[model samples]
Target chain A: MSDSSSILGSTAAPDREAHLTPAANKLYGLMAEFESPAQIVAAAEKVRDAGYRWWDCHTPFPVHGLDQAMGIRATILPVLVFFGGLTGTIAALVLQIFTNAMSFDLWAIVWVRGYDYFISGKPMNSLPAFIPVTFELTVLLASLTVFFGLLLLNGLPRLYHPVFKSQRFARASDDRFFLVIEAKDPQFSRTKTEAMLQALKPLSIEALDS
Target chain B: MSTLVIDNTWDDPAKRAPLVLNHDRFDTVTAEICRVNEEAKPPMAWYVTFGISLALLGLLGVMVMYLLATGVGVWGNQHPVMWGFPIVNFVFWVGIGHAGTLISAILFLFRQKWRTAINRFAEAMTIFAVMCAGIFPAIHVGRIWVIWWVFPIPNQMDMWPQFRSPLIWDVFAVSTYFTVSTLFWYVGLIPDLATLRDRATSKVKAIAYGLFALGWRGSNRHWHRYERAYLLLAALATPLVLSVHSVVSFDFAVSQLPGWHTTIFPPYFVAGAIFSGFAMVVTLAVPARSLWGLKNFITLRHLENMNKIILLTGTIVGYAYAMEFFIAWYSGAIYEQFAFVNRAFGQYAWAYWIMISCNVITPQLFWFKKARTSIWIMFIASLLVNVGMWFERFVIVITTLSQDFLPSSWGYFTPTWVDWLTFLGTFGLFGTFFMLFIRYLPVIAIAEVKGVMPQADPHYGEEGHEHESEHAFGFQPRRPEDKEEDQS
Candidate 1:
């Protein structure tokens, strides 16, 4: 209860903190609110240098350099999407070749045999005829991977987060910038993290509910 | 209007015009865009337009019901001209969707910053237009319920669609196009939905937007992968746009008919798709920006840029027409020559000329800066381009089908009331989706638009942003700080 005691009431001079109220419950993290990208990007550098693992800088938009400032590495999404497309390509080829040119038993609930059907005098195993569908399937699977793959990686469609429990965190989608160092982080401490955040000169720092 | 147009914007790169006008801040952009969705009362035009669209949609539903009950006989697809109004409408709608994907994918790849303001709306248009397009083919099969036969899924009939067939390729092409485009559109929308969720004034608004926002917290960690995923989608969607229209063209070009079979169809159709797609974007944008007070974001410069694209693609379409004629004559194939000559001078010459004038001559007006910047001129030209593109599909489908090789089975295909109403009803379907879109969703890409602003730069204020951002990482060396101020 003492942790969230309107860290607001204690640090009310900044005026920008007028809208920020840290709700009381279990201490989730320490949140530092900033007014601009410059401030947060600078603050992020210090936080990263402080060696906290479970810290994230939130902003209204993707700050151009904040990733580099935080030492974030490039993602493996492109490689994943590439393999995803290859799977689609292989799937399309097997589906077409087996269904149109070769006979094979495909098992589902029961056996469904695919027999070759000769039509329009084309060869039984024509690759040219199959190219269009193959291309479509390649794109379809690659895109699905990008879509679902991105969400799964991001841990999205999560309806609730402890940061969302903070009234000031609403501005994360608006004008303000935020630095959240979760209590679960090994480097996160009551006095030290709050002191490091205070040294960044953010308008306000609040202890959010878990 | 002239003041808003911002002519002479490029005398120097140092004093370039801002993409978002009126010196807007982050909150203002959100406020301006979110106000429309948050407002309890929309303009009376929203009501009137939605009413008309709903009525037209009702007409389409009735016509489709009539067709389903009475059979494809209710429309005028007869012996020679079997691909009548339905095929024409199908190609036209599909082509219209190309602009949306082109804006979202191709322009984004090219790093066109202006697209951020309009891509969301255009992509929404693409999804809706594709939905309208799917209706015709699904119902065109006569046995509406058996339409799944188009896909390769094994049914109890134990049949596979002929992979060698262009029609079967079209089935795969369009369904895949729809699914991928919807994925791309929804992926782009997730961030904005989070904005709406945060800005929600009511519990229902919160729930609706929250469900879609997927608990986005503007996390840089998430954005790192999200940005990569977006780039991947854009790369995938770019070729997908070209292939979709190309495959649709294959439905005609792969056929043996003289007018229908042409190697040039793919490029020509893709060009025309971009041409008409830009036209449709301008057509939707001119009214939307004005209606929603989004003039600051969807500025005239964006419209002018779109007009230039229209001019380019339209001329390409014209060249394709001339090439088609020249190729037909040069082939020394009598049927091909007859197809070209008859198209220009035959009984259906009126439709051919309408296509030429609207698709070719109309966009020529954009060569004049006055026409491109003038809202009225560009809007009318866009409308004309749309009309011309529709007739181009018509001329292609009808001329080729009506008098191909056998004059014995020649039939002048006239669409019944069902065909006319059904086509018009698609407009209703497109409009209804658009109306709903503008009503609830953020029409502009809120975060993306913010990303382009100078304020988004980390070193925005201090030594200016552009200079430091020359580094690929946009990282700048930190300056010595005053420890006294921090300890104050």
Candidate 2:
């Protein structure tokens, strides 16, 4: 069984590579490489005008309005961050209140007294006094929540990506921009997508088979 | 073969890039950059920085050595005034440290593009300021060796730190602040180190950068995780900065002292911290850009923007001052009223006027666009802001301590040589760190700066847009071309 699975996986790798070769379809979607953010954005606008929904823009840095230009909105992470923050707040409040008010008080001396002396004209259980501790707990919990929560929320820790397959993708960190229209987009027909992407006039365009 | 199938549609983590900077960029900078990297060593601006910072540092070192040799009896704290210059300097330095984190973390979280130019240095200033601040408290305790008593340690005596004490909270708050800020600063350095790593030619430089870079290879997955984590840290730090200073303020306000016990101390201290912090940034940045020839990167628009913050925070601080006075008068408390009056006209009245001149009068010039943009004027204003902030602390600590409930105990306090030396020495310590930071670290975030340039962005093409493009990633649009270049 193991040998069969290994054989299947090895065979699939070549099949995947062969499927991604651009020679299979010269009319594949154009992948424009841009040096400037402006070109990517302008091309994105032109593609939008050309009614090409399948095309995408890429850059080393996130181009402003590029998302809106490409008509992208709202990732799944923010809602996740919100829930994480909320949980953090709740957890902080509970833990602090329990620890301070209940858990570990050595009240042997105070227990005999029916009531405790209230100073500064306030009762023993003043909410305001609890504020500092509550706030500290809130911050502590919220911070941990955001950090780890973001990690978990984003489903991270895996260490590979398809963009890494493109050697030029490294320039995204320095001074380069990119835009590609995937074959998967509903509007992506090979010929029309190529025509639409060509009209935008990027620095260079290549067909990316994935 | 009865093979079991696994789900591939669960959002494959393999789709995301592992890191941000790849091997190519790193290799180029490492091998070719120092010689060809025109921006590496712009010109001879360090002479001026070294001269001033070195002199100040020398003064500080001499002062601290004197204090350590002598005792804690030096600067002004007496029987009723257990905490004077040391406490005042602690608060002042801590306040000056606020702007750095506030600018780097809070503004970064808000997606302010203008922050890119100065945030690196600003964050460094924060660390240095905190260092200077941590000193006063440590030394003020006299037997510095036993300062560990402030920590909640399970020792042979079996005594725990008083949980309810504000001073205990401050110990946690300050330590937490320093740790977080250091982490934040180093985390931001990782990418820049990769840039340097790629540029380095010498084996030692390569090793240094490599070690700092921690095997970073600009994989997309790395960027995704890094970006998210950075944002998360920024979010955490913003609240921590606020909370730390608020706890610091609580140290005085929680105590039932005549002028010290006020509800307004937190916001007041926070405002002053931001004000002094901005002033310190301006002071350093104005000189730095001119000295380092970073006119294009650290532009005049950056100065103007910082000035705007200085003006805003300064006003808030001024208002807090006025409010304190008003509250004192409104409450009909003689001691409170007397505290304000005495602050303006007592033995430390000179300090009060200096504070007024620096805090209130100087920043007002920034209301004018011309004044805000002028490097010289901004520098002077920044200097004044520091002086004023110091005096403000002096006024607070001294005035309150000089006169308490009993008129019989009300005696004038003066700083001995020890107090002065330690104060000076701490300044030296801060200057040394800052000087070293500027010399070594990429004082500006190279990648972040490149990100903000006009040509780097995808929207602007070659024709009319002369040079560069900047990217506005998450929130507020960040563009370098939008910045007004520094003429100086």
Candidate 3:
């Protein structure tokens, strides 16, 4: 998992082709096109069982059970969002306390602050008045975390990908489903992988170049 | 063969009308929606409307500049009724903003499949309405230049916005609502943008759409995370929808004013917000669906469903009004009794009557199926509801302030030309943004709409001999008999 995460982060940058000569650039992967989401799910299960770590399924919309088929673990986004909400809550409390309730004073020998200021005859550190801002800030941070966390987890903002260079790959976002097994996978062998995918009765198979 | 007796149960699938009509393939769904952006040139009517919206946008800019330069006194705000048109428009637009989030986040959470047809534009409307709503309070601060003081940024002045005040809570609530809503809208747009990117005929168009798509290749892993993020956002936004209007209500309910200070304001304001928001959706959608040639996608069923919501929320709001009066009477508070009585017979009596007739009376027509189905009736009712909601805020703000505890301070509030233009300019600004959005983006969510269609399901029509007839891409060929049934 750590190895895959490292690869996803840096080494597998899509633009690495710019550094290599035309002759040195190798085939990125073999992409098999499937007719339906069911077929792709079946293929994904097969690929997962075959112990191919660097393979992925692509579909027009999310297939209900594809995550299980691909052996993809549940995301850690909720935990991150939880911490974010906690941070927001603490920050709101500290900010409101320091700004509204506590005031600073200078003595003859030393300075002192944190004197409580009362407004509207209400007690200092009014918990009820703090609830709305605390709640709002918590939602704000948690939602922002969800958005950015998804992007980071997906390793997105990848404007170009080698798989996109395949002519048949355009249909992946329209009406077709695809399964791509990259050459970098430990289990990948051109002849064996091609024969294995061929057994799945895919619509077509194409080699994607880097 | 043993005869199978199909039970006619209340939960029977045969009783329901299909959500998607004229069942088509996945490819057709993409082609139909993308064709609007690809093949259909902007019509003369589109150009003319865009032109008018742009002129209005220019007018909005001029009005805002004048308001900032000449000061807030250009409007009708004065002693006793210092909170005038600016606050009225703010609450109105903010209330109008609620329907979009309700339809998008709340409906999405409830597993309402019908939301797919209109959720995209409804979410866009949420973002645009918030933008319009945010403009009012920023300018209403009087000292617009020092608006940053609202934030708790550390400064040499050592002064922070009073945290105990509901007004300060409103700043956090509204800004957070805007940010979360925008994120939800944009995240949903990425897949559809990819669809547009793939279909673009020109290189320039392709790159532009591609950039926004952020290299989305629709990988199942990515979709997994995307779906999770979307669900979390919807969960967060649900409470936010409740909190935003509740805090806005706190702005008034926390005050000592007779009409404004009521425990009922929270639920009352929230209900009114949803009511007005749904009305605005109907008002905009009725013409938009027809004008854009989107009758098939934004079907009459969607309109009927929305009208039913309008009916529901309208009743809730009317009930709240009655309860407010009943509570006032029940409490034996003389001031509260005077506030309610004065509202119906005061100088703003005309506005109060308009509010009741438009909000309570007009939506009751939706009780008849014919009225709900009829486009013209729904359109007129929706417009009336919009006017009623505006007057609702007007009556609440003006009437309460006009007849306060001291008879010496009593005065009628009249909006000046600047006040009227600023309100009109927000409409212009909202319309201008909406027009541009409709032109450039796929207004209906292409991917989400496709997700709801029959073909997208893995188990669609897998029973009996029909299993063999499952065509490629999960699209079963429509037989002549099936076509006839669909037509009937």
DockQ (Cα-based) per candidate?
0.39, 0.09, 0.33
Write the candidate numbers in order of decreasing lDDT. 1, 3, 2
Evaluate residue B299 in candidate 3 and report its C-alpha lDDT on the 0 to 100 scale. 78
Instruction: Give the range of the ten consecutive residues with the poorest summed lDDT in model 3 chain B.
Output: B479-488
TM per candidate comes to 0.93, 0.72, 0.91
By TM-score, the candidates rank as 1, 3, 2
B343-455 in candidate 2: lDDT tens per residue? 88887788889898889888999999889878889999999899999988888887788888889988787887666666776776787778777776778776666565544
Which CAPRI quality tier does the interface of model 3 achieve?
acceptable
Query: lDDT by residue for model 3 over B80-199, one digit each (tens)?
Result: 899999999999999999988898788888777678888888888988999999999999998998999999766665567888899999999999999999998899999998888777
Those runs of model 3 whose alpha carbons end farther than 4 Å from true positions after fitting are A1-23, A104-116, B1-15, B464-488
Return whichever of 1 and 3 wins on lDDT: 1
For all candidates, what are the clash counts?
Answer: 0, 47, 0
How does model 1 score by TM-score? 0.93
Q: Name every residue pair that clashes in candidate 3.
A: none
Best-performing candidate as measured by lDDT: 1
Please give, for residues B1-488, the per-residue lDDT of candidate 1 as tens digits. 23544443343667656677763479988888999898889999899999999999898889899999999999899878999999999999999999999998888887777798899999999999999998988999999888878877777777888889888888888989999999988988888888888878766677778778888889988877787788888899999999999999999999899898999999999999999888999999999888889888888888989999999999999999999999998999999999989999997999999999999999999998888889999999999999999999999999888998888877787889889989999999999989999998999999888877766767776754462222211223333441111100
Q: Report the C-alpha lDDT of model 2 over A75-182, residue by residue, as the tens digit.
A: 344445566567755764543343333334335633211223244665445556556654554555455554555445444332232333355544544556667766
